[model samples]
Target chain A: MQQIKKDFPIFKRTINGKPLVYLDNASTTQKPIVMLKVLENFYFTSNANIHRGIYTLSEEATDKYEAVRKKAAKFIGARTEEEIIFTKNTTEAINCVRVSWGEKNIKKGDEIVVSSLEHHANLVPWQELAKSKQAALKIIPLTNDYTLDAEAYKKLLSPKTKLVCLTVESNVTGTIVPVKQMTALAHAVGAKVMIDGAQSVGHIPTDVHNLNCDFFAFSAHKMLGPTGVGVLYVKQSLMEEMAPFMYGGEMVESVKATSATYRSGPWKFEAGTPNIAGVIAFGAAIDYLSNIGFKKIMAHEQELLAYAKKMLAKYPQVKIFSPSQKHAGGIISFAISGVHPHDIATIFNNEGIAIRSGLHCAEPLMNYLGVYGTARMSFYIYNTKKDIDTAEKALKKVLKTFKL
Target chain B: MDIYTETILDHYQHPHHTGALNDATVSATEHNPLCGDVIKLDLKIKNNVVEKIGFVGNGCAISQASISLLCDAVEGKKISSLKKLKPKDIYDLLGVTISPGRIKCALLGLSALQKALKLTKN
Candidate 1:
């Protein structure tokens, strides 16, 4: 399928007369026109504080807001609506687990296995949790091809392991992990699994039930939804002891003279006035993505990755750090031998092809790859072959400017 | 032709005064955690006079080149003189118009030097 360029208004703009070609999907995606309209319609028509409203508008807002929970549940293959909790973002969701679930389960001397390829969102909370609880954090290293070494991960699992927190895909390298097989391994050793789907849930088919992961966290913006909204899917069987990530507002079921009791289901964890418009818009985004189908999106991205690889190979100075397309997702992380990645990005900006160049929020991975940072070119449903041609021309400008 | 000019690229490719001082009187390291850019400055001072100054870092071209340029400009100069150096001086030395996003990158080495000079006096 061709990119519906008109569907995104940003594609109509130009930088110095150069048409815009957004190549930063790994960072965040440009919202479609339909998504924008959803946000507007919610504010214009159905704006009200949900779950606490008594009027008709409030009830209508509440219905639209809670309906997204069901959509998100089916989107991720969660067993029921009660299993989904709306969070501010993936980072907050992971932090929620660190405090709500991790504090009660992980004790001193217990081990948590995490891969080195995780973003700071997935890595930092576990590090802090392990530090505060005095637990052990075991790391799984990446192989020669930059994919997580599954063989090495098997060695890290044991009865002493209490949790396995990792990303389903590495945002920096776009390497997809075998989360299903890894979750089964964690389960065999009586360990719970938490999958950071910030980079994978929207790109691939994620079935929390099939994977059997106890917890799954993902952001909405990564999947064509609105920002400031994310999801945390907790298995119903594990919810008996789960505490609210925050405690206030409608979260408290009843107030008493001495003590208070909180509500059951996901409402207990949602402790404030939710992002009503963002959630409703995110629900619309879910329907939009489902309509396109993951199969079409994946196949289109695969084609983009292959074509970009062939074009990059022509330049001897171009050095790619992402694994081959078979293992890699849609991102192409690379550096031109002598030129800095930041320089390449500035040059791309001039060419109107937006790309990201930095540590990409995965500093430990940068340490592993032995580079300061890499320039990344990512693809989504909106990008097309013509954008690749523009990127090729931009690369030529960069090499010429650097005299490489 | 733009920010990545010939002089900037030359310094980035072949940085001057890049290494650690063995008997340095003062040293400081600064990092931009937002993008993981690191710059370390080592100073050798003899009775308030700048005897030797060197740096080491792994960052963007603007940051790395700015440090290399900073080292060359401050060598053999008094530490007190560097205390009054302003951001504009580095901008002029780099010979490029830095955009708002990269202002921090251009000033990373300067900040490290300013801190290192302060520590040397103490």
Candidate 2:
């Protein structure tokens, strides 16, 4: 934990004249020094466009860019590097799948199954696809505890289901959806599966092959990597079947006045000059995580979450949203009685403790919970139990301050 | 806890003119679902002047206290005058420059008051 804290230089700084205790990992994790330095080194040395020139700098840039792809492929346990395609973020990655796969495959009368506990990025693209394709967008309801009922999910799946797009971990509730089981079920129904791994990738160890999802989407920023970079892992066989979403310079093999030939699979998906520095920095982030061991990171987070739950449970004013499931990831969402989440967050901010308060880009889940929003504290390796202790103390003071 | 200024905290802890005003001609409820801040404002107007102003709700100290302060500031004032009250007035009264996000919480009460005034004028 001490070593982990050292990696984040911003953690040493102060906010509002007080020591910073950042708990907004669910929004975006702080980049480690290794990731930051990797970015700096790229700009300082190999500052050139990738895959275009035979110059040494360009060759170096291209190698670094493709190397990150290999790292990202291994990071998510993709079967091959060709399955990975870079995009702006998870939002874009999901959009790529919606445009590339849904545009071609989804027809009128087909269905796309998604869970109620999805971020707007995961939900909106599919809704737009359903709208354009005249397909049915079926949402599997969440149980009272915020878990997706497998029975309800099974009932939602049918031969008419063209795709099942869902999040692996809900950003709002921290509920880990049974993605592997759901993927298997979707496959059985002959529907493609796309798991939104935006909130899951660095939070937990993910194996795409083991899960057997047709595609997985996630952002680098959520995993202590640079922003403006994300990965969309398409199954090799499925990649061959899907059409390209975008067309332009980097992706095309040849262009004529009337027609154009495009590159295959991942290259075809990447249409323009990508975020080279961000992708390179992402490789550094992967290395940092690999060094720490994802298992150790997961264990640390689980311990923190357990401790946080136990500490917060003492406050009767506090209402926890996520179920007390062992499989739930390291996010805690709760509402303090008599105090609005914004108020709680405001008070915490004054104390130099950052937390996310609102629907967390998951309005459907917020509606299902019957709460307007919640104050969410998400844990990463850099976070300590002491930080949660400070948050708890601050929360108690906030409750008393509000006369709750 | 210091998110609310000392003045605002005082008002929150001992809210003035809080609770429903019976026989009130105007009432409105405003909510910031993002924060779970709910304010139920009750106002009585006579001859275009606010005869009484009161509020009841569940919220943070900033929100509740801001409403209490709003009640004190708006009572006996013209409903038309209250309609022009901006969030900055509340922030100035609190004597703190709130973060952009918390400005909404600080202003939730004023927004409710404005809504009530709008209904009363109608």
Candidate 3:
């Protein structure tokens, strides 16, 4: 197994005079040294605008910028480089799809399907689209164990359904959704499918082609890369059908007094100067993940999750929220009987252990689970069983201190 | 990382004046759906003054404890005077600067208080 801890410099620092045990990977993964170096090198050496400049520096910068697009294409198994459009983050990527595809295709009486497991980023855009287009927004309910009811989802789909947007892995429940099956069902109904891969991409292997999704969106920061860079993958055939979300320089073919011709899909969607350094660092993140091998990373996280669940089970006051014994992703969400999640998190913080407290961006799921909030501990390759042990110890101390 | 103060934790561990007031003239509930923090405030008013205050609901320790602190702060004060309380004032009482993300948690109690005060006027 790779020594995942060695790649991150932040782990070397002390928190509260103790070694930091970061369990907030679900919010944002810590950057690897490789990605940090790539960003530094870009600023120190090749910092210039792309596509419009005639200087050697601009050519080099453009080459590197476009190279990252190719890497992104390969990473998500996009058939062509033109299918990948870069944005500020996953929220921007999803908004682009809503504005472009949703605006043109969805009409009054049409329906868009979403699940309760969505982050606000996914839910709000669709709600706005539905309101503007006079379309209906349908939601798939979760099972008692917090898994999406696929059977219920099938019943929700109909000829009126224009699109289906779902998460690949839930940020709160940590449930690995059946994206392939869901995509197939949506496609069978002639409705397009968009997968939110924000929690899946680098944590697991993602192939857009194999998943047969119409669009896939993920952020670089959640995958050990820099922030402000995200990828949107549209299938080659669907790219032509989707309208441009933004129109500006570098995306026009020609201009006349009356009309202006726009460039093809991806470039046409990216409006202004992009986050060049963030994109270059994203490629470095991909390289680091590829070198370590995603399979090993998955295995390590699975082991950690199992150990965490087992250890947390010993706490009678604790209530775990995800489906039992499933190979869910690294997140573990639970609530203590008498202790509020914020209290648990604060006590853990004093111990130099970091965890997330709240709805984890899935407010609907929290409502369905009938809880105020939960304390979430998410793992990555750098996290180990020892980290889980530390979290458990800290949690026990909190429970006892609270006299729960 | 010290987003929560020691007093906040103490209040969380041992909440003060937590319950419901059956004879309350005003009552209201406020929730932060983003974090699933909920607080219900009940106040008994006499001659336009808050005679007693109570709260009951589920929330993070910060919110529950803050509500507990709020109960103590506004128990005998005039409703008009207590309505002027701001989130920063509450944070100052706790002696800590909360994270931007957690400001809602601290504000949950104050929001409930305001709503309950409005209810009493009605």
Candidate 4:
């Protein structure tokens, strides 16, 4: 992990002349040298637009760009490359599903179920869809221990349940949901399932086929890749059932003034000239993570999270929201009984420790948990136990300053 | 920890005037919805001078302390000069450099103060 930390230049710098202790990996993971080098290499060597030219450079660029779709497909265990649609980010990818699937299938009286723990990217779009189509947007509540309540989800399911949008892992509480069990229930009621993988893909091992989810959405930026590139996986069986979110040059096969024939498979979803370099480099990011292996990464993160948990236990005023270390991912959302999250975060920042404070884009979850906000510390592949120790030490200083 | 000095924490722990005034002439409120920090300002003005000031809120120590300081800053000052207050003044009053992320938290009180002054002026 020390060698891995060296690959990210951000760790080399000092914050306020103190060594930077970064624990905000859930917001966005810092890119490694390998990812950045490939990104630069693409712009320098193959800068041509994909699928637009017969020239050598364009051919090479298109091959590299499309190759990422293949890499992404295999990375997530999708049946084919045709199932992967590259978009701007996870938000855009989820919006693509809402635009293409929700607009077409959801109708008045139909119910779209979302879990208690969706990020706004997965929640708000469904709300808008329900508002537009007059569909019912239902929610699965969380248990007291932060796990998704299975009984509430069963009660929400009916023949009218058209879709169930869920997060594979919550960004705020770091609760790794049992998507397989929930998907089975949703399928019993003939509802399609979409998994939000923004906080899950890089942190946990995932297999789309084994999970049997109808769709999955994730971003490269959160998984050690460059920004502006994300992937949406549509089940091959559902491909013809949905329409494209946008229409432009690359998506259509042949067009007249009034009507056009669209391309089959994932290409139909992509409209514009894509982020060529970012997509190609995304393949490199997947390669980087795959080579390191998720087992190794998850083990390291669990150790860091356990160390954080132990450190936080020393402060009796602290109330942690995430359940147990085994049931959770590598995040810990907590509040020091009297001190607000913003102040804790500020104090942590002053000590050169970087953590996130706020509702973390899950305001509904914050309301559900009966908290204004919680200070969050998330770990990643590059994070070490020392970072957690520094964070804990800084938190003690924060407690002293607040007199809590 | 440049932002949370002893003076600020002192104000945070023992905040100076809190609660709404029943006889107040003007009042206003603002909140940082992202973190749920809220500040409400009530001002009692007599003859174009601020006779009394109070803030009611719950938030981070920075916001609570800053509002507590603002409570003392507005009293006995001419109402005309109150509207001219800026974030720089608050920073000067607190004697600490605020980072960009917590600027909203620090200025939430001043934001309500400016809004209350608008009503008090009329």
Candidate 5:
């Protein structure tokens, strides 16, 4: 873990005269030196328009860029590289599915099921799709314990259910959903499933085949890769059936005056010049994570989450919104009894501890939980027990500063 | 810590004029949707002048203290004059430097006050 910490140079930074204790992994993880180097090196040597130029540098750039699709496919256990589509981020990837598949499949009176735990990225797009198509948008409510109510979800499915969108892990509550079982349930009702992997892919083992989801969307920035690059894994058959999300240069096969033929596979969905350096660096990030392996990553995160939970339990004023340890992930969302989340986050920031305090882009979940927002602390491979200890001291300072 | 000084903490801990005005002429509420900090202001006006000012709200120290100080600054002042108050005035009243991120928290009270002033009849 110390070696992993060293891989991220941001740890060397001092905030407010104190060592940084960053716990905002769910928002975005710090980039590692290896991934950063790959990003810089690509621009240095292989800066060229891919798939357009016939020169050697362009060919080399195209090869390196395309190779990441294969790496990403293997990283997530997809069937083939053709199943992966590069987009801006998780939101764009989900929008790609909505525009390409959802807009076509969902009809009037059709049902689109979403869980209570979904981030706005997954929820809003489906809401708009359902609204535009005059379809029914049903939600699977959360239980008293903050986990999605499985019984309610099963009852929500019907013959008209066209799609079920759920997150692999909640960015707000950090509840690791049983997506595989839920996917199977959606499949039983003849509905395709799209798993939002923004929070899960980086922290846990994610296999599209094992989960059996039709689509999976995640951001590179949240997984130790650079920003502006994300992956959308579409099942092979579904990818063939779906339309191209955007159409322009590189996606077209032949341009007639009136109509143009489109390229096959993921390239069709990627319309213009993609994030070449970010994608190539994302490949290096995949390699970096693969070298460390998920077993170690998950263990370290779970340990940190458990220790933080233990530390938070000592504060009676603090209320935990995440599920119990068995179902929780590497994130913890909580609020003090009298202190607002913003105040808590400010005090934490003063102490050089970075934790997110807001609705976390999950306002619907916050509304359901009956809180304006909760302060969140998310762990990753680089986080240590010492970081959690510093966060605890900051938490105590918040209580003191508020005179609670 | 710099933003939360002794004066701000005093106002936060012992807020002034924090009750709903039953005989109010106008009232308005403003909130920072992201932070969930809300400020509701009630005012009683006489001859285009503010006779009394009160408020009730829930939020962080900065927001609550800002509104507390705002109540004291606006009471007995002319409604037309109160509308001229700027965000800088609120920062000056707080007597602390408000960062860009906390600007909304610091100005929420002023926004509500101005909104109430707009609702006041001439």
Candidate 6:
């Protein structure tokens, strides 16, 4: 774990005269030096537009860009590279599905089911879609312990349900939903399921085939890649059925003055000059994570989560919102009595420990949970027990500062 | 330097002029949706001068303390003088260098006060 910390240069820096203790992995992971080198080398040596120029540079660039698609497919257990469509970020990827597949399939009086654990990126799009189509948006409720009510989800599914969107892991509560079982239930009612893998892909083992989800969206930046690249994996058959989201440039098969037929496969959704360098470097990020292996990464993160929970348990003022260890991942969201999350975050910042505060882009969930916001500490492969100790000390400073 | 100074913490712990005015002539509320901080200001304006002022809300120390300080600064002052108050004045009142991220928290009180002023004018 200490060796892994060295791979990220940011960990070496000092903030407020203290060593940086970053616990905001769910927001965005720090870029590895390997990923940085790949991003820089791509721009330095192979800077060209893909699928446009007939020159060698463009062809090489296109090959590198497309290779990442195949790597992403293999990484997530997609059936083929043709299933992968590169978007700007996870939000854009979900919007792609909303515009292309949703507008066509979702009709008036239909139903769309999402969980109470959804980030705004997943919830708001579907809410807007339901509003535009005059459809009903249903929510899968949470148990008292914060895990999803799978029984309630089964009852919500019916023939009228056109789509079911589920997150593989909750960013705020750290609850890991049983997506495979839920997807099967959705498919039983002929509803297509889309999994938001933004918090799951790099942290846990993800297999689109095992989950049997029709569409999946994730951001590369959350998994140590550059900021501008994201992946949308549509099942191959659905890929053929969906229309192009953005219509321009290489996405077209042939252009005429009047009308044009779009390209087949994932290229249909990628319009304009895409983030070529970001895509190629995302491939390197995948390689770096693969080399470490998910088993080690998960073990490392789980250890940190357990340690953090144990440490936090010492303070009676602290209330944890994450599910039990068996049902959750590396995230630990909690609130200290009489202390606002923003105050907690400011105190942690003074100690050079980075944590997230506020609604976490899950306002509805926050309202449901009956807290205005929460202080979240998410762990990754590089985070150590010592980092958690630093955070614990900073948390003490928060209580002392506030006289809680 | 830590943005949370002793004065900020003191104001947060024991804020001045807090509560809803029963006969408030004008009132306005402002929310920082990013962190879910909300502040509501109530004024008892008489003859275009501030007769009394109070604030109530739930938020971080920066925001609560800011509103508390703002309430102290504006009471008994002329309405026109209150209009001249700027963000720098709030920072000066804070007695600490506020980061860009916390500037909104520091100025949330100013925002609500301005809105209340607008309501009174109308």
Per-residue lDDT of model 1, residues A303-339, tens digit only: 9989998988899999888897788889889888777
True contacts kept of each: 0.54, 0.62, 0.88, 0.92, 0.67, 0.88
Ranking by TM-score: 6, 1, 5, 4, 3, 2
Candidates in order, TM-scores: namely 0.97, 0.89, 0.92, 0.96, 0.97, 0.98
Instruction: For model 3, name the residue pairs that clash.
Output: none
List model 6 lDDT by residue over A1-404, tens digit each: 67888899998899889899999999999999999999999999999999989999999999999999999999999989999999999999999999999999999999999999999999999999999999999999999999999889989999999999999999998999999999999999999998999999999989998889999999999999999999999999898889899988989999889999999999999989999999999999999999999999988888888899999999999999989899899998999878889889989999899999999999999998999899999999888999899998999998888787
- lDDT tens per residue, model 5, A1-404: 77778888999999999988889999999999999999999888779989999999999999999999999999999989999999999999999999999988999999999998999999999999999999999999999988999999989999999899999899988998999999999999999999999998988988998889999999999999999999999999988789999989999999999999999999999999999999999999999999999999888888988899899999899998879888989999999877779888998998899999988989889889998789999999888899988988899888887788
Residue range with the least summed lDDT across 10 consecutive positions in model 2 chain B? B1-10
| CAPRI grade of model 6 | high
Model 3, chain B only, scores a TM-score of 0.91
lDDT (tens digit, per residue) of candidate 3 on A181-243: 999999999999989999999899999989999989999999999999999998888888778
State the lDDT of candidate 2 residue by residue for A122-209, as single tens digits: 8999999999889999999988778888899999999999899889998988999989989999999999998999999997899998
DockQ of each: 0.64, 0.42, 0.60, 0.80, 0.70, 0.82
**Quality of model 2 by C-alpha lDDT:** 0.87
Docking tier of model 3: it is medium
What is the Cα-based TM-score of model 2? 0.89
lDDT of candidate 4 at residue A100, scale 0 to 100: 89
Clashing pairs in 1: none
Error of model 6, residue B90, in angstroms = 1.2
Q: Which stretches of candidate 5 lie over 4 Å from their true place?
A: B119-122
State how far residue A282 of model 2 sits from its true place (Å).
Answer: 0.5
Q: Using lDDT as the measure, name the better of candidate 3 and candidate 5.
A: 5
Local error of candidate 4 at residue A62 (angstroms): 0.5
Better of 1 and 5 by lDDT: 5
* lDDT scores of the candidates, listed in order: 0.90, 0.87, 0.87, 0.90, 0.91, 0.93
**Which prediction has more favorable TM-score, 5 or 6?**
6
